[model samples]
Target: MSKNEKYSHESYLEYQGKYKGIWGWLFSTDHKRIGLLYLYSIAFFFVVAAILGLLIRIELIAPGPTIMDAQTYNGLFTVHGIIMIFIVVIPGLGAVFGNFFLPIMIGAKDVAFPRLNLLSWYIFILGAILAVASQFAGGGAPDTGWTFYVPYSSTSSTNVIFALTAAFILGFSSILTGINFIVTIHRLRAPGMGWFKMPLFPWSLYATAWIQVLATPIVGITLLMVIAERVLQIGFFDPALGGDPLLFQHLFWIYSHPAVYIMILPAMGVVTEIFPTFSQKPVFGYGAIVISSIAIAAVGYFVWGHHMFTTGISYWSRWFFSFLTFIVAIPSAIKVFNWISTMYGGSIDLKTPLLYAISFIFLFMIGGFTGLTLGALATNVHLHDTSFVVAHFHYIIFGGMGFAFFAGIHYWYPKMYGRMYNIKLANIAWGVLFTGFNVLYFPLFIIGIQGMPRRYFDYLEQFHTGHFISTIGAIILIIGIFMMLFNLIYYRHRGAVAPSNPWKGVTLEWQIESPPTHENFEEIPEIKTPPYLFKKES
Candidate 1:
């Protein structure tokens, strides 16, 4: 049989199309295909943002301007932050893996609304275009930072309107995706599959989706208010017109703070899945992990004030937010301990995915602990707007979420593409990336304590040594990233075909055919027990 004929009988990949070539993919409503669509687009923007980050590091290597002037540097900063936060990390795991695997894992044919899922991707792209277009079409690139703090955001000559519009639209896309996931999980589980029996990945998504649906609207409304301030001279955020800038900060953090959980929760879910599968054992404290996810989401909302401790808020409010912030960390710590306990006596497989998972725990621990310093009013007063804050943010987002993303890609790459990446190359790439990552960000902790403010194009001579070392780390990190990307691309065609259950996972997804059939299952699977139940073969 021809490839098309063979796929026609089995997987979505082989489905014949009315529109040949690119058009088919563009219009595809297949959850797997839509997931790949997100993967490709997100990867492209990730590279763009990474390159911009490297440029910033290179310029900072010395005390003076090395590559571009200050204005150009500021533009790059705004664009980089916008792309990484809104485009890459926020939707990273859910849009790619969740869309592809959630239905299969739950024994459903597809998402509750496949068309809306696809529409979300298009809206994301449109938001990205408007954000980038602002740099070229309007007065100049937006320089108010990703937060778009006012009265600077309102009074700035650059295309603040475009930036605001892009963020507003992107919020809509996020909200829609959240709605889709919530409905799917609630309504689509297989026969005998109860809420507790569901896999950790979907459980994580369940928590994340709630945050996305609830918290995103606050930021959306805030961004719209910003546009109003710019275009209609609304006195909402602009102090010049009887508006309170502090109010903008409050509204923005109310969303953005919970938004951090939106980025990391799915990643935690990814780790949860990888642990039991690679260890060849059941997850440790599955209930605790699930409950912690809900706790993080619930408590995440009340801690936004921690970000504004230095904004002259009430002393009681400051301490209250700090208490909530510390409280949120308890559930996260519970998860870490459980993961380690899961691997204690099990048959641990040191695969690439497992390696990335281990790294995530290490890096995320650092990110979490450092965040406590920022939560405290005394330390935050010293570290506010400093490079220490920048380092902490990246550790959580890049070190934590970014590594988990790598873990998920490697863990599920075979299932997604029916091919294996070279294990040796993957290990080598992880070593270099891990080493470079620490060298790149660790020194910022020292310099930040010494009072080096972030977002400056130039720095005092005392900070030059740290910047130089960090710059070198960036170079090394980039090299590792390129090598990893090259291996994935090259092996896509040349690697050996992967088996249906390469890691010997017990999830419903592992029970299906690799790259799964168009409708996922000929008949829906009936769950006999909770997920991650391992069986020995004769």
Candidate 2:
């Protein structure tokens, strides 16, 4: 038995019976339960956000505020983006998967700071509650974009301050989780596990955690300034208060650009895991992929200026920002190349996880390539703030992050729940989603090329056709999402019983029993080789 398990009480072994009902779930702090708490909570928010997304798409189908007024539509997209990014996607991967699997993957008893990990979950819950409360609080919803760009955002009629405050609190939770992971990795590896011997997903979390610790605080402080400007009327971002709005952009993007890294690094980790297991080989160039993750995280922060090129920032600064933006793409492209190369000659298995990984590669490629176009100062002058920007970000955020999040969930579901979902149904869901995704975003490229600004509830005659096609695609996309969620969650109790290593994956997590016991391992397993070194004999 593990050392911690030896000391743990009999009550610890009875995790399932700790509380008789929902209250048990609300208060439980076992990492697995906390992970499931995140799973259900984040998934709930995702459904809410999807409804808002569908609403936005529906209104755009025929254009000119078909279902609601302009202000209502503005509130819809704002809340949708805010809730999805802050409440769902930000916490979805790292907190949900990392909290549950990181310790188990590395052969540890618990996170270095277990109670603090619990506290972080509570803080996240509080932040999520505050975000939801903004809808019913003073103003209907914050009309400010997720970025919360200032001066205009500061002076908006909506409850911008409350929403920004909620976001800041969430950033605290994210930073703490990152710190816990970094310390745990430093102190808690199993007997023979070296840096290279660690699994790629946790390594990705390690890199992502550093970005969280370092970059999240910048945005936190920036949001604080926004709240101060609103409440105390301090003019840090206000020209009338003798502050430059441009400075706000500078500070915001410092965190916000790296914040994109916060969003995608975990997803990269997901793809990294899927490619190796499904390919049935050691990950090709594991060291290169690791270096590329760090490179992307480090370089990600310098590229935020590309978002400011057309905002009247200096031309010299614009050129510098543009250069860095293009430079950041190199590391990301390297990751994609490595993933494809890993699958090149291996025995490919097209399971649900592999399907998501394949989609991630395609969608992220489109998102990345389009980003290059927007990064060039000359090209951005034409595309800035258009539907093009909308399409580009969704491709990265929704397409890239969304697909990878699914990959992780499907990849880890058997281990976490001790059940296997219906494979044919899961693949059908993926097929629908794949078609729906391209149909939905591809037309935005058309409307953007023809000039339709985003965040406008109303638009011109020229943009309607493409908008309609995109809206129909959005409906298809939502259907696919619902089917996917149902299969994953509903099938848990009804699904087939799973084996520990159903997919023949080589990771340490697969070596343990499904729905792992209170004590994660039978014993602390030694790692004599690096992760993903598949053995043919087994």
Best by lDDT: 1
lDDT of 2 at 257: 81
Q: Compose the digit string of candidate 1's lDDT tens values, residues 1-538.
A: 1222221235677676676678788888888998999999999989988999999999999999899999989988998999899989998998898899989989999999988998999999999888878777768888988989999999989888998899999898899999999999999999999999999999999999999999999999999998888888889989898899999999999999999999999999999999999999899999999999999999998999998998999999998999999999999999999999989898999999999999999999999999999998899999999999999999999998999999999999888877788999999999999989999999999899999999999999999999999999999999989988998888776777777899999999888777788788999989879897888521
Tens-digit lDDT track of model 2 for 383-481: 999999999999999899899999889999988877788889999999999899989999998799789898888888888899999998998999899
TM-score of each: 0.97, 0.96
**Cα-based RMSD of candidate 2:** 3.9
By summed lDDT, the worst window of 10 consecutive residues in model 1 runs over: 1-10
RMSD in angstroms, all models?
Answer: 2.2, 3.9
